[model samples]
Target: MSPIEAPTIEPVSPERLAEASVWIAKLHGDARGRAIEEGLRRWLQAHPENARAFELATEVWDDSEQLRSVVPFRPLRHVEHRPRWGAMATALACMLALVIVGVFWLQNVGVVATAVGEQRQLVLEDGTRVFLNTDTRIVVKYDKEARRVELRRGEALFNVAKRHDWPFIVTAGDRQVKALGTSFVVRKDVERLAVTLVEGSVLVSPVLPTLPEQIQPTIDAPGSIEQTPVTTALEARKGAGEFKLAAGQRLTFDAGAVTKLDTPSIEKTTAWRRGQVILDDTPLQAAVIEMNRYNEAKLIVADPDAAALPINGLFQAGDSAHFANAVAQAYGLVVIERGNEIVLSGKPIQ
Candidate 1:
């Protein structure tokens, strides 16, 4: 059976729209406060247009897919008495204008970012679920023909929903990883891009100079113009060295070349998802770097010998103090607490 079409909504007045925008922001901002909730309830009950306008504005906000870009609505500051309707209405109008502009901006570009010691899960308009790790940033662009994501920094895991006609591709640095109906993780660093496939398959290849023009949609003044459908399979195999990675396999790209292909332990590679950092004979320096990603206080290996020590353990993410203490006891190193920095140095041999 065909899906029923949703009825078209008439345009709401600017004043009403503005009020609705402010109400939505306040409600979202102070969801647990009873005062705001009761006030909003009374406001909605006072006028029929209030409810309709709020519903319309909310629908637009939900559909925009870029709520992060919008300026959050802040409650009005305390005043001597109740403000006049004219003043309220004027404030609402300005907010509504900003909402309109934000909606348009989000239509073309959407960005998601996470700070240190933070993780985020987001479902895209295409139904793909993305799990972003600490200090991660990604830009998503979806159009009629293709769905694309650029990993600007850090790491993310993609659980892509199947849409054979629309290819799912993630680009980081000079490499592109293409997948369909698969789950994979992409980590971007200063000099390398790593693609690890947990289930299904993916093609990891170098990004050609001309590839961007072929994949990105043509944009005009108002909106994007539909371009030719990107052929994922063909593009993966053309003009570059491509490595087909199966489940449990990983492909690392460095310096515009395929550096390595290995089958790493999936649990170890994805340990961050479970809020733990697992180290299996990892170098002390590298382990310190991993732990520091999750904490504000930095960990520093003060000696070359201490930095080269082998580390193996499973510890909660951001437990730098515990890690430092453990390492000091095990290796007989001195742990110097210097403000926010934890420095590990080898004990002097007597």
Candidate 2:
């Protein structure tokens, strides 16, 4: 048998649609506190049309940037008070025309990604800017309550816009970073997760699991092997405590049970934005890993000695040859080219 489908929801009448737009404007405006919320609840409960109209208006608000310009010129009235019906009809007609002509309902949710050695910049409908590093993938979804972004892989810097009523959150693996109006970077590697706050505060916490009833149970035969979920040491050590990170602070979570939290230099943390990598006493193996993130060519430290050598200074990203030459001249090592791999080996002792 085929799966069941959800019932389709329809929008409310034209007059209610106009009133809903006014309510949305009021919600986003300076109006606040219990009085505003109470008024909204009463309006929504008055009729099914009022509720449906409000829901449609929210979707329009999420997708239509033009809707912002249509907000009332005069100070918004309280929810308890109603605007003139003739003016409301005029507004509704204008919104319908704009929706038919411009708004397509695509920008409210989508995926943004970048390839290796490629960088990208995107501005969301809410005016928040996202800067993606090499080999990054992020999913952006905006709703009435919040603006959410899932950092599926690689790293990205979020310069969030201020929306006090609407929160902004980024989720990576089991962890999430919540912000209001701030700048921060979240990087997800194969075995590690790093969050660095650049200019604003963010709350770093574990993502809560879904409700019990929503989870499906799995049954196995008598001789079958039970599948176990993989839990990293970092997650095991990261208890239920939520961390509030201030600007310039960095949190590193890896396979190790220890979670390191420290204040790192903002310049070094964000140097990738400039297509440069700055290494300060970083091991050859570690530096190689960082450089390979931006280039198709791979760098291999041929021996343990070569891999342990310390590297420093700034170098252009994706320039593996330049980095290899610098290392060879400085440490008297041998650089051998093998296909796409640049092998660095120690000079043979006499």
Kindly report which residue stretches of model 1 are placed more than 4 angstroms away from their true locations once superposed.
Answer: 1-108, 209-240, 256-258, 348-350
Assess the local accuracy of residue 178 in candidate 1 as a C-alpha lDDT between 0 and 100: 86
**Cα-based lDDT for every prediction:** 0.71, 0.71
Candidate 2 local distance difference test against the native: 0.71
With a 3 Å backbone cut-off (N, CA, C), the pairs that clash in candidate 2 are none
TM-score (C-alpha) between model 2 and the true structure: 0.62
Where does the lowest 10-residue lDDT sum fall in candidate 2?
Answer: 66-75
Which digits, one per residue and each the tens of the lDDT, describe model 2 over residues 58-136?
Answer: 7655543322111111122323355564455456445543433121222467887788887766657666778788999
Candidate 1 C-alpha error for residue 145, in Å: 1.4
- Estimate the TM-score for candidate 1: 0.62
> How far is 54's C-alpha from truth in model 1 (Å)?
22
Tens digits of per-residue lDDT for model 1, 91-198? 444454464422211222479888898776665655577878889999988765567899999999999989888788999977788887999999998887788999
